[model samples]
Target: MPAVFILLRSLVIRLLSSRLAGSVAQFLRRTISTGAAHIGTALRHVWERIRSQESKEAVLGCVLCILNMHKKVET
Candidate 1:
């Protein structure tokens, strides 16, 4: 029946929209946490290197190298 079909379609759309919203929320949360972890790691590494008397130039070079590598991978 037309009424039954319409009801089914509406239910399906609602279900799918809810699922998509959930997926997007999960992706955003994961992205934010991953970014935070990376920043924390970089800060810790820099602090440790500085404390260990590593050369500033060498640390800067390493950081630049990492950024370049990330850029390449992203592309």
Candidate 2:
């Protein structure tokens, strides 16, 4: 009876730990994807501005502002 209780306890612990780890991994993956999307969008906007022959200084300023905003959001 003692051995059976120990086995059951161990099994429950293992299951719980595995579930916690999976949840953490999923959260990190989602966070990374969101950050990547923000950067990609910023870059695309900058590129479009350049292609449109917009002022270089203005484009640079916009990109910098976007980066600053991203940094703030991440923190």
Give all candidates' CA lDDT scores: 0.85, 0.85
Give the TM-score comparing model 2 with the true structure, all chains together: 0.64
Candidate 2 wrongly placed segments (more than 4 Å): 51-75
lDDT of 2 at 40: 87
Alpha-carbon lDDT of model 2: 0.85
Worst window of 10 by summed lDDT in candidate 2: 48-57
Supply candidate 2's per-residue lDDT for 17.
100
Top candidate when judged by TM-score against the true structure: 2
- Give the per-residue lDDT of model 1 (tens digit) for 1-71: 99999999999999999999999999999999999899979878876758544577677777678878855
- Deviation of model 1 at 68, angstroms: 28
Residue clash pairs of candidate 2: none
